[model samples]
Target: MAQPLQPAEPPKARAFEAIVDHIERQVLSGELNPGEHLPGERELVTAFQVSRSSVREAMRVLESNGMIASRPGDPRGAVILAPTSGPLQKVISRLAQASASSLADLLIYRMTLESSANSLAATRRTEADLLQLEKAMARMRAARAQGQEAFSKADLDFHDVVANASGHALLRISAEAVRDSIEQLIAASIEQSPDDHALMQRTIDHHDQVFQAIRDQDAHLAEHLARSSLFEYYGHLLAKDEQIALSALASFGSNTR
Candidate 1:
């Protein structure tokens, strides 16, 4: 008796990936440039021979990474956008919310990355970086005269400049990731009340000290200040959390009585 030959197994289905692969190839191959509009959903469906839903999902993935943007009712609205770190912040925030990671983990991550950035920035900062840092510091002072909310943005910008001046894109990326991910928690945890004027002044003073360390090219002092700032900030957050828990317990005991 003769044995029959069987056909080889078919390749695994990559239904979702087909659209991704096509878009990525076009972008990499220079067919898609910044500000160029991509084909609409119906056109993509016909061109890729994939379902409309698949194309839409792929577009969303691209959108999240700042590859393209779609607006309502315009045929050419699905245009390419120049990618920026803002999209990275959005992605990081979404991931944090979805994963339910704790604030402590985020602070730990920031400490590790920012300490290294501070050490590097001490040696690597340019004159332009120093000017930028000074501008941000001035903005912080002006914001304080206006209000806390005004100051908060300048405070955040100062940290961003420091990270950027480190001359390490990865450090900038990591710092933004942690900060964006825990932004909501930070907002809820840290308060800047009028009564806390002295605390705010101390924060500004410490920032100046760190800035001077970097300006002087004192890497060791820069690193120490960066790490100490993070540790102190994390301690404040933990203390607040404990205070809330104790308040809740006290309320519960009163209710039971």
Candidate 2:
């Protein structure tokens, strides 16, 4: 017996998404550039052959992703924004807060990414890059007497400098996202440590060693020091098995570099 063929399901309606994709392609293709103004909503609606609502929705999505900025009462439509890691930071931070497992994963990912960034920074850093690193270290040292909050900010700044020195956009963005995701956890750990001053001093000393390795252009040492510092600071938070796995990966990254 031949059964009647089932009717195929209709495709999903995603007009706004299509519009968003079109704009993104244009921007990526360099047809639209940062600081350039997008066409007015009506123009986009006509060009995309979609409704005004669809065009508006697409613009909102783009704005949320840091791709464009819209001001109220501006007849010039939205301004194209230079891409930034802000959206990545927000997404990573949200995911890390979603579960203990996610936080653990974030830490492992950061260890790998940061070690690579340190290695690259060591090999590629310029005089300006070294100066930035030194300034960040100075801030860390100065903040030691102030308290954990100040020190933590300086520590983050130092890592930012190291990531920037790598001159890899993806690495810099990923490092920033991971750092933001774990920042609160790091601060809480510092606050709960029995000897805050000792911990702070240890951090400053670790930074100094990493700074020296970068200055001397010792890629392997810089990578090893960065990984070791991270593991030393955060190993207590991980389960025994996870800690062992992360340590192994850190060794692999340092050795392979």
Candidate 3:
């Protein structure tokens, strides 16, 4: 006769995760800083009361998050990294592509993020921020004669400056990720336009108006112009329902501002 079946065991938390959590707390609390080396593996094993393998696993996690780096054949521990949005942006763009997110979805998200960023920049931007914006605008103007690709890059740079001026790190990172992910779409839109010259001029004029509004510290006008510019450029690509929704947003911006 067979013995009674055993119950399935519940999954246990990995020992490495505890080490990861401890080190993450240290970094968050300012105990660890960029360019500083982590304690050696032996020290981490002793401190976390875990095996060497667990300590190694913890290091791997931190490295993947761009929080630390290690050199091969070096006895020194992993170096703490200055935080950057690069890893976050890569992950977001990858997920969007993997999930087959649509161009319309990307545009809608951009419109929302940029409009908010413009509004925030109107109030929070410093003189240096305004200088950056003007520099980007100047670059765009200079790039116009260089062709569509150059103009597009400068155009993106301008948006990046505006996003950075919003005084919100999350907004800046998200906007940059979304914009980078849609480079092909933007290029296609330019290539497919009936009149490339007209399109380029419209883009420059829109940026000029939005920048002026931001410089003037007119939050409502800045937001309205930002949203309107996006709608004007990408509205035709959107579904009828989306166009209707965005139109309502533009109307709201006009009345509210």
Query: Using lDDT as the measure, which candidate wins?
Result: 2
Give the clashing pairs for model 2: none
The sequence of per-residue lDDT tens digits that candidate 3 reaches over residues 1-257 is: 99988769956679998788888899989999889998899888888888999998999998998899998877989999987767866775676666543666777777788889999999999999999999999999899899889998999899889988998878887787777776645556544778777788889999998899899999998888877887777777767887888777765668654
Candidate 1 vs. true structure, TM-score: 0.72
C-alpha RMSD in Å of predicted model 2 compared with the true structure: 3.7
Q: For each candidate in the order shown, give its overall lDDT on alpha carbons.
A: 0.73, 0.86, 0.83
lDDT of 1 by residue, 1-257 (tens): 98887669867656557777777788878888888988788888888788878888888888876788888888764888754567767766676666544665566667678778987999999999999988988887777777667776888898889988999887887787677777766776675556655655777887898789889988877777776676665555555665454333223312211
Q: Which stretches of candidate 2 lie over 4 Å from their true place?
A: 1-13, 93-100, 184-191, 251-257
Q: Which is superior by lDDT, 1 or 2? A: 2
TM-scores, one per candidate: 0.72, 0.85, 0.79
Q: List the pairs of residues colliding in candidate 1.
A: none
Query: What's the lDDT for residue 137 in model 2?
Result: 91
Point out where model 1 deviates above 4 Å. Answer: 1-13, 22-36, 39-47, 51-53, 82-101, 186-194, 239-257
Residue 33 in candidate 2, Cα distance off native in Å: 2.8
Native-vs-model 1 lDDT?
0.73
Q: Which candidate is the best by TM-score?
A: 2
